[model samples]
Target: MTDSDRERWDARFTGLGPGEPGPPGALVGREHLVPASGRALDLACGRGTVAVWLARRGLEVDAVDVSPVGLAAGRAQAPEVHWIRADLDDGLPVTGPYDVIVCQRFRDPALHPALIGALAPGGLLVISVLSQAGDAGGPFRAPPGELLAAFGGLAVLHHAEGHGEESLVARG
Candidate 1:
């Protein structure tokens, strides 16, 4: 993302209320899939909700997002998380052999390979993003089966696209 994009996101997040703590969407009912002890990374972790959630679950967590306002909000609530401010357009800001990696509401095909590579063997990956499959077309949305095709090498557990969203849960 460009500086303008970062500024825009910062502004938007700065104007928002506090973020609510919540588990990652994919881990809602499948919480058992999360390892009880291991490192996790949350990319585009908007206000550190999931990052905080993972840390509370006994996993070391690193959360990254480009917006400082968002990071600050996260920091206020979960200071335990290692928050990294980075423009992912420069590529992933943190390296990892993570047990759990989540990228929600963000799409970037270029990072697909890195995301797969970052996972440790048998690690879990949870991803969700806007999709054009069942929603009106948009420049930022993925086409049908995008996640399924991009991360085909992983052992897929669940995949769905509809209602303007596409979600995937898989293990490496």
Candidate 2:
């Protein structure tokens, strides 16, 4: 991301108050897929909601985002989860062989390889992003089959592309 992009995200986060933490959209009904104990990573973890939820699920979690304001809000809500402030444009900082990895509502094709590399074998990956399939949207939205093609090596458990959103729940 450019300097302006980082600043924009920081400003947006600063303006919004912390919201409730919750499960990944794809894993809401299939909560059983969440491992009982394992390490997890939440990329672009705005306000650390999903990170906190993972911690509550009994996994050690490392959450990363570029916005310090968002990180602070996450820290306030879940002090137990480690919060790391890093620009993802520089690449992922957390050395992860994590059992679970999540990246929601963020899109950067450049980091796709790194995301896959961060996961351990047989690990679960839950990802969601804006898409153009269901509704005509802006350039940030994923084209059809983007998620499936990106993480195709993984054993796909669930994949959906519609409603201007795309989500995938898969195990590597």
lDDT of 1 by residue, 144-165 (tens): 8999999878999988789988
Predictions in order: lDDT: 0.90, 0.89
Candidate 2 minimal-lDDT segment of 10 residues: 12-21
lDDT of 1: 0.90
Q: What is the TM-score of each candidate against the true structure?
A: 0.96, 0.93
Top candidate on lDDT is 1
lDDT (Cα, tens digit) per residue for candidate 2, span 71-131: 9989988899999989887877988798999999888888888888889899999999999
lDDT of 1 at 115: 97
Residue 129's lDDT within candidate 1 is: 87
* Candidate 1, pairs of clashing residues: none
Candidate 2 displacement at residue 11 in angstroms = 2.9
Candidate 2 residue pairs in clash (backbone atoms < 3 Å):
134-163
Collision count for each candidate, in order: 0, 1
